[model samples]
Target: MFFFKKFFKKKKQPVDSQQTTDRQSVQSVSKIDKIGKGKSQTSRGLIKSNKLFMAWNKNAEEKKQRQKSGLVADSYLKQISPKKGFTFHSDYFEVGDGVAQILTIVPTKNADRQLPPFWVTRMLPRGLGQNVTARLIQPISTKTEKWTKDNEVKADAAVRQAYGERKVNDPSNQDIAFQVQDMHQINEDLRGGQYHGSEYKILLKAPDVETLDSAREQYKLRLKNNFRGLTVEVFEGQQKDDFENLLKSADAQIGHEKKMYTSQELAGGYYLMSKGIDDITGKYVGVSEGDFNNPAMLMDVDDWSRNIVVASKFGPRTGSYSTEVFGDHLRSISLWGVKIAEDAMIQNHRVVHFILNNTDIEDIGKRKIGADLSKHTSNINMGKGAINPFEAFGREEDKLNVYPTLTEKLRLMFKEMSPSLNDVDLNKYFTQLLKEFMEDKGLWKPNAKENIDTISLVGLPHNEYPLLSDFSLYLSTIFTIYQKQGNQQAIKSLEKIQGVVDRMKEENGDIFDKHTSSVVDNAQTIPQVIYDFASISERGRGIAMAQFINTLGYATQNLHRGDVVIIHGVDQLAPEVKEFVKDNLQKLTRRDVRIAYLYDNVMSAINDKDFNDLTSADYTLFSAMSSDELEAYKETMKATIPSALENSLISKDDLLYYLSRDREKVLFKLDLIL
Candidate 1:
């Protein structure tokens, strides 16, 4: 899903019910009903051709439908999809007929189904700032009108506790700083008067005078009676004014609203704009763009706190690094240096300075840094560890539903296919072939010899860049295959090379991963991984490719038959690789994956003979770097790698001298190929 602040942009592309989606994804919404009568007001505009999928937008005809359906003006709420993505197994409540909202049942563990208390928070008119909401429920039983109010108190408390415990936030600060403007513009754009803040009392409270006085104390301390204005005499029934008042409030009681997905949000790494609150300095503040670590306003906040005047605490900023950044889509890659001013800010990501350029480590290793000059630096040691621990994000691979047994079975079939596994003397050759078989399962990589460890691959004489590291596992299988599978010269050359290691093979040295060995130990290798791969029915291949190809992990439940999967970067791949991907992807449909031939990089380079087939379904490459980007990347590497080395063990002169005298080139800038 993509996030854009412009609400109107969503209208350009309504959801198509025919879109292929597994049963659970709410995104695969098939039908939408209007909140009121007018069967003709169904989602007729949503049934558009799939050609628009190229842009991958989430547009809707919600406003036009809202007008045509002539539903109550307040029925559509704010028309903003909640931040939390869709979810299933969550209870939803119906209102009258066609509309129902996703319900948030609380006091979760001890929830009493008989009296299960659920809460719903709807978006309010953007202009109001105070607590402008009231909870109203149409009871299904003799649950007293008082129960609705009491339920709301409990519900509101539970919601607050839930937010604190989950660290989830809404657009509170954004509402304060930008609401009035958003309200005015959205009001005109949506062409409705019900959306006006005065018409809705979303933040007003129906408290008695005494209740109002009690809540006003805190605001007095805040030097503003903000909460008091939210109180209003309780409105007992659902009147037109009541509906308008509550619609403008800060919260809502779930009623009817189908075709909606809501849940508590789970963005942990960085939180920029949570909400805006009055600072002791007596000004509203919420930052939108800056490093999460130290924005320009941080010092101003610090200085104010230290002085005798106003003291303000910037609750949090408006942007997030884990979730967002300014201008969007900065894809390639670069290394940046970090300096932490305070230990408390350790986890914050700061993209500030470029410290090194020549990123060519081969050149750096030749000359040593200080005492460590005693040995060459290894990528294993210098390679940065994997980024943040994503477990909290619900992406644990172990927990990911993978087909471990079938995956192993497929591995075993690979071994039985190798020609030399029959003879005891071929045991050595069998083991070597086993490794090749497994490596071949990683289709995203080119069909060539590759070390299981990627750093080692780069250490080879000629290594491809962009690393192709993400999907390496997808193309591999059981027994390692011959360098050029089924080629006689390559096979003899392989045996001849292993023949020299014969004496060593006599000793027991096995390289199978525990899980891999268990499956292959059972026998029956496939004729060859590629042949087996190609021989599968297009139906089965589509299923396997979709299921197995994931950045999350190798193990996953097989995709159901007919499920489509898209292979990216296909057009830009080397000729042979492109053909293999295309041959395998024929059975899938466009809905499975977008077969784009251009990405951020160059899309049409005159240099490649293969550029003629820019529309080939075989390639995933959307675009390649332009001459300028490629040239800049190359130029940056030339300087950065050298600067990085200057700070390393050896001096630049020593590295150049060593490169000029001993090595053909001390370091080949890998990205130089881009």
Candidate 2:
């Protein structure tokens, strides 16, 4: 919430004062009053949907509290006493069901030199033992020293040298060392109270106003009779002034909330459970204690996506390192994947469900009171041919690859693969739908006339599919975040490639002008010339394969160890596809990358006995229903039959939806079309 837009040092212009203030003011108000009454009226939080969050967090008491909290959500100054350093705090808080109190201490005139007294330090919790229990009070930060970079480097060098040639930055060992000695001091004043940071670091916490006062009296005595004695004060909250101010300055960052679970999210999770997902050690949530037992009301889905069904539960803090103990602590969870589909023949409703997840996130707390975490619910669609992405990508070599019209190049790719990359093809119309990507400098266009079929022969990079240029986009270091990256020579090479593509586009402009749609529509079958606009001699320089690969480096940015991905919808797998998949699969598996995919395409795409089965028992298979099957189930449910019979026939929605009676193409796999 404290993130501010970095200034762009562009040419100066006369700024509109009101416009700028308004832009910043809205965000500030929301942030500042995040825990107050105004927050409820304009209820925005880390979660994607408001209705879902309220269902989990909002209680009858808060509804009334919010009305009052609204008055102080902003720095109205009118309601605040308007004292110089004494802020008029509503002391608003979003803490779990309990009284909250903020304890403030005015430093004595000699406070800068003075340290925590011996008597006070003896009472504090030392991180070493289990007996120091946290109850009504939690001391925030208390620091008397700053860890400078110079000292850090010295510490690192010393620690690393001690390990005898071992890497200096072993994470766990480093963390433990840093936590213990880095930038910390043994407070002699408080009989060895370990403290950190440069400021007076007088901040502390208590559960209620009374405990705060008691803690203050005990500490204030140390500064007794000073010229300006330590004056401890207590307030109603624990949020920092800086954090509140940041929220007040920003516009709404929370996602729009929806009222009810979309038919898909609920139906999908429920159906998955029926398929034995109940054993996944999952979390069940709802508005109340009984809700977990009664799963019907709590639509189970979770993640950062907007306007979808989710299980009922309190969310966690948005900031992992920063704590906002004084205000609303609700946060959102990053979801697996989201898919939108129509119920088609089943109740004619819209369905939004979690995709790619094997089970819902495990609920760590009970349903009744309140939870400290800011997490959300999660689930995956488990239909026929369903395989867990995690299990598929269990070995690093398991791979997921996407190809447009793998005719020959696809073959070469397969020849390169190891045996590991085996995942089924979902065959939704997505992998071929063409992604809309653009470089700010327009690095998407490629030379159609210059085919890079052979890495050694091509003058420049080109696409085999002519129409791919129109729907075509490319990754190059030019306009992407990679712009201005690398050494001068590397940059020059990219520029040359850019020039080549520009020339190609220009040379073919006349053709596009005449046959735009016709040419693009027939990309797969079109002659190579349709894509390549000029001769290699005319194009001058060729873009290297390394350049292309370097540009695509960002694709792996989100990947991490043990993270899984499913590459689906690449239709008609060929030998090259297999080879490429295997090769990458092995490579990724070697690096612990996990993957998964549908297996149906093997039946239609690969009939050769020489090829090994990629979709065998190493992975679990879920028989998800296609949209046709869902429709049939829906129809059967709606048929003039008993409720018992209706429930038995419709097992689950396979995330497949038929746009019409006939299947509509699933463009980019953004939507599900059976």
Off by over 4 Å in 2: 1-275, 279-560, 598-674
> Candidate 1 at residue 53, lDDT?
30
lDDT per residue, candidate 1, 1-674, as tens digits? 00011111111324568766445223323322222223453354334323233222334354356556765544564344333432222222112212222111112121111211121122111212243222222211122335433543554454445445543355453433243343333234333111110111222231233333333333223222222112222222323223332333222322321111111111111233312222243211122121112112111111111001100011101222221221121122110000011111122211111111112222212332112211311121101111111111112232221123223322222222232433332334434443343344331123232422331221111112111121122223211354436656546644543432231122211111111222211111211010011111222322223212211121111222322121211222333223323432332222231111222123222222243233222311111233353344335324232443233213211101111111111221111010
Worst 10 residues of 1 by lDDT: 335-344
Best by TM-score: 2
lDDT of each: 0.24, 0.27
Model 1 residue runs over 4 Å out of place are: 1-557, 560-575, 587-600, 604-613, 616-674
Residue 145 in candidate 1 has what lDDT? Answer: 39
Looking at model 2, residue 294 earns an lDDT score of 15
